[model samples]
Target: MVPQNPGAAAAGRAAPVHYTHRQILEILSGLMIAMLTTMISTSVVGTALPTIVGDLGGQDQLSWVASASLLTMTASTPLWGKLSDILGRKLMFQSALVIFVLASVGAGLSQNIGQLIAARAFQGLGVGGVSALAQVILGDVVPPRERGRYSGYMGAVFGVATVAGPMLGGFIVDADGLGWRWCFYVCVPLAIISLVVMQKVLKLPKIKRDTRIDIFGAFTITGAATVVMLILTMGGKEFDWSSMWTYLLAAVAVVLVIGAVFAERAAREPILPPRLFRNPTFVLCSIASLAVGVAMFGAMIYLPQYLQIVKGMSPTRSGLMTLPMVAAMFVTSTGSGQVVTRLGRYKWFPVVGLALVASSMYLLSRLHVDSSKLVIGADIAVLGAGLGLTLQIMILAAQNAAAITDLAATTSGVSFFRNLGGAIGTAAFGAILNNRLTHHLTEGLAAAHVRPPAGGGTSLGTPDAVQHLPQPFKGIVLEAFTQSLQTVFLVGVPVALVGFVVVLFLKELPLRSSVSRVDQAPSTSPAPTDAPASTPATAPTPNTTA
Candidate 1:
């Protein structure tokens, strides 16, 4: 008999249900569009940042352009997931798509860098919502034992976006009159199309709960995250790292985090339930996700920039350069998902994957301005292979470890950390690049004995515009930019390895064949076997794996 889980009963009365392959695919078709829409919205701008900043004249705030969206996405992820548990999944999913479409409009219409960042921040709210719910809805239908089959499809969608976004952005930016704003505009049509498709295709067993939304928990957490992001993205650039304002902001962040912890403890339907942290799988997966986020976004956002700025490649060429990495990601992510489904084991994927990620980052650090296209492609391919292995597996492990009632919470918790890592990583790496670039540029220019440009320092411009700089100055600029990028890539090595170490402690629990936690099989294979039997999602021993 399956052991009774009190937590499952307390959350909501879930009806046991399942869908056929056709039905599942139909639902996924719409979900994939939404996923593609958001994923494209992010990467499409990776190659466009220089042009965006050049047009708006806020090179210092360039990182904020990306960080603003990521910040809101990270902060709002859990709230979206938790709310879906209380509200209807279909209702929540559609709402997010609409929000994303409208925000895309605002982003495209923006005249200033500040306006664009604001619009992106709003867009991130929808991004956070749609991404979390997509996974939640998947859990509602696909049993943990079989989730890998569908997860491969999600990985494929992600791969496509990674490939298409940059290439499209490059083509648009390079094409006359289309401009970088079109990058934001391109996602709107896709999002609108997905909204209608999801409305008709997606269906789920609704769990209606009368519990109050954790407004306090959400507020404190959002506030804390915002402050931390401000410090990370702004500290050295906005003010000196050791300035009094930095200390004040740090203290405020600490207080807000403490408030969030207390609020969550008291909340009836906490945005992030304190109980989920008790599960070792959840905790370990969260760590791995956070580290991976740092490494993944750090690479994705910069590789294209490096090619365009330092190597003097057109935006289109830069986008094309990333194909190897994206291709590897597609193959490995799909392959790993299938392997996990067939073998019923996932722990090794992450342990090995994260190691690959760290090694890849090291390989990237080794790149110079003169590195061959073959070497560059091979290094990033390693990164793609690493990410493909771990990205979906971490979430799968977390979901399988959770009670069915906690599915939404578990999925959101992992996503929240990953986005948080991305936001901070993007900003931190940007700052690292900018800081090193400033120093190297100054020194290189001085060594060259070139007079300072009109703006006093190196006047930032689009990749094409930068090509117009005269002789030794142009040569110095490439060397300095390449050197700065080296630091950014090297810093990522330790960060990804931190994830590798944390994942080692993540014990692989048996996958569940049933969709409901309360209906799991009683028997569990306690030893290694060709196919270990499924296990019940028991209440885990707090802070202990056993």
Candidate 2:
């Protein structure tokens, strides 16, 4: 017989176990701590990277530092969700915290870029869990109607982390003798505190489950995602776009995905169940997520470059300049969440958000070398407003569409795709920026009657030396910056348009308060062999797997 409380067998005794309001609050606080701490780690590093790369003597590896984290996080996202479903929420949450803390320490102490990237990959595994599982657990503790307020807090935490990360990273990096490694050092203590608080305060019902996990599906999907990411990373950079290497990688990714599809179909408990894709809301939301991820990530990643490269701002100053956008996002997201919670409606946000995003991107495309700082800042603010409206609400939409039991997995699936899109966007757009910049620089050199450098195509955007170019050359470099940034905006326009289209098809569903999952479960009364009885609402249908 399945034990009613799984923790009972471990404790070997009955324990008092009704959760009160105060107890639930205490439990949620642990999750909030973990959420803020993890987001801080992500944003802080992005701001400090310029300093870190200069010290490490490998500017080439800068993208990899970020890419490594995204890759592992994307690949492991569904695994975390599936495992949490099988292993009990509290166990997975605490385990994720411990892994994150240890990984934070390793990241801080790394001596080389390779070590740093490897540590980040490991750290990402925990980050992947924390982000996915937190939302999952939140769905458990709160009903859909009440979840908006909490989701708002999550958006605020995200905004705060993004805004604060750059400032904090800049401070730690610029502080005399503290060095860039301390940026990583800063989060370690916070993580420890989060861990202790979680252990002390968090108490979730343990699911007494005994089921086989879809190990093969996890492996296949991970393989598929990794291969696809590699293709995006290496295309038009390390290999020719039409080269054999490109075709080979593409083929491998395609084959693995086909295998994964079949594997998911057969698995007793799939990591990413193919059936979820058939839900119209889930499908549209996922598509919209891809577009939103591309637009948001590509723009954010490049704006700092525009500040540092063309505007001639220091890393710290650039980070500060980003405050307006991040700040605007924070306010709007929190306010919108509360409004949605109170009004009981949300269909308009995505439509309006994508419109704002598209308009803002179009405005940003108009930026040139001579554009004023005021204009650029204004554009970023508009983009931030769009993002504030889009990101978390799509998650709410996905949650509302899913069955109660699939809440965590469905939410994480949306998150996983969004992040996966971001990784691909960042890598792909970075390559585009590099290629376009090089081409413009070459054309400028040719027009100026200047000889190409002896070794040919030496790096032109070196941070220490870019500002020192002669007057006409500096103008040319800035023009290249303008051109490359314009291309990013051009690419983003179509992405937002696509998002607009997908969101138009989404069906509106009512947001409900928490369901009584335990109360609704089937009764264990023995079947009466001799009398006809009415079927219960909880009785399993013929096709029901559960």
Candidate maximizing TM-score: 1
lDDT (CA) per prediction: 0.85, 0.76
- Which pairs of residues collide in candidate 1? none
Residue range 1-546, candidate 2, lDDT tens digits: 111343533343222144555665776777778888887787778777655666665554666777777788888889889888777676787788778778888888998888998888888888888888888877766777777877887888778777787778767777898867887778878878878887777655554433468888988988998888787776777898899999999999989999999988877668877778878888888889888887787776677667767887766777787787887788878888998899878878888888888888888888887888788889988888888888888989898878665677798899888878777777777777767777887888789887554443535534445677766767777787788778878878888889988898889898876533333223343322211245222221111011
Q: What is the lDDT for 26 in model 1?
A: 91
Name the Cα RMSD for model 1. 6.9
lDDT of 2: 0.76
Residue pairs clashing in model 2 are none
Q: What tens digits encode model 1's per-residue C-alpha lDDT throughout 254-371?
A: 9999999999887766888888888999999999999999999989888887898888888788888889888998998899889888988889988989999999999999999899
Question: How far out, in Å, is residue 323 in model 1?
Answer: 0.6
